[model samples]
Target: MRPIHPNAPGHGHSYSRSHIPVHDEAKAHLIASANHSRIVSIAAQKFRRRENVIARIRLVLRILSLLLCSGILIVLGQAVMVYYKHKDYVVKHNGTPDLRLWPRGLNMKPTLVMLGASVAATVASAVLGVASFSKAVRHITRVGNVVTVLFSTFCIAIWVAAAVYFKIDDFDKTKHYDFLSYTCARRHDQVLDNAVGNLGNLCAQMRASWWGALAESVVEIVSLATVVWAWWVGKRGGKYQKIGVEMLGSG
Candidate 1:
């Protein structure tokens, strides 16, 4: 029998074309897709981590502000009450003395404004801080940041006014009384001491309240800074995402 060549016309079997190029092309495409997915996943993870860190920082700052603002509110409330009690004593002791002679700067209106502003700040910070933990609600953090900044600004203004004007002309100048006179028991007149029991303590309380207001302002400023930081980070992250998408599309 003659040898039958594989490529002979009568041959029933023949070699198919090699599929190496097509296989390699397909594999390359698959690898490219996987790499793109991996890159995107990594980028997403980094973004989430950064976001979480910012959120946590915001939460801490807000909590601090909440505590400080609440403390300020409490101090102011006590000071107002103590002043009224002293007034009551004066009225009972002196037989309806002139209201004009009372302390100059402890007006109830301003005190109430301070109290109301503090309460507003406290509630806003508390609500936003609690919302930071939820991924679903975290989307609203940016809005919360804006709201926080507004609240902080308002609170700072109010607190600064209160601190500066609190009991401005109430202390006795004859005894060398200065802004901090009552704070340290430097002024001890018999009348005020007799009318307001523990007069030194009341003065100290007022001083503390003013200092707390200042402290609250400081915290508010810091909180506002954090909000700005968050916005910057978010803007940067958006740019990174845009760049990443361009790179993937080009690939």
Candidate 2:
């Protein structure tokens, strides 16, 4: 074979170092991509954790609201029972105790209004609470949340109205009837005393129901705030994730 020249096809230049930089660049690129992927994964995990936390908080609030409203409903139900019992007693006795002698205890209209509100709130809370557990019904969950918020608002208004009416009615009845002072003199008459006692008990129940309504309204407002906070967090996280994905894709 002829002696190979320096610049020949299979000569001194056969072993080349130019490919080293390309290899290093490829390795660096892979490492950077892997790091980005890890960062995204961590972010996603954190976001899911936060989302779960919010969901749990909301569920708890919903249950609490449900319980509160249920309590209110029970109280109002007792009031209604006492109210009807008093009417039946008066009719059966042919007004022997003379209802006009006693202070009017609970106004029927306001009591009914509060009762209805409690029922609505309780039902809404139950439905929404159940929906929250189901990830497959996201649309329904969103709609339920909106309905709950609306009901909360309406409940608050009605609660306030009923409470104010009760307050005003109580004041008027107290001023006109003056039953507290009359109780001493009427104690000798068993029927009158029993009638007075029954009315007094009914009034107490009404007061309790109105107070419970106000408390439930406050809980509803808190629940609404949590819902809004959860929504904001989810929206913000989604925006950040989108931005991160865009950045990774460009890179």
Candidate 1 stretches greater than 4 Å from native: 1-20, 88-116, 123-141, 167-195
Q: Which candidate number maximizes TM-score?
A: 2
For all candidates in order, the CA lDDT equals: 0.64, 0.63
Count of clashes, each model:
0, 0
What is the TM-score (0 to 1) of candidate 1?
Answer: 0.67
- For candidate 1, lDDT tens digit of each residue in 1-251? 99988777877654354534677767776776677677667767776777777666666766787788788777767766765656443324466645422445534554556667667767766776676556543432657677667777877887787666554534444542333443245336555556556667766766676677788889878867877776776776677667656666664
Worst 10 residues of 1 by lDDT: 175-184
Q: What root-mean-square deviation over C-alphas does model 2 reach?
A: 7.0
Q: lDDT winner among the candidates?
A: 1
- Model 2 clash pairs? none
lDDT per residue (tens digit) for residues 1-251 in model 2 = 87768877765664465535787867776776776677677777876777677667766766777788888888778756654655545412664643443345623565566678778777876786677676532222476457656766776777677667655544563542222223323446656555646545555565677677778778768767766776776676677677666666654
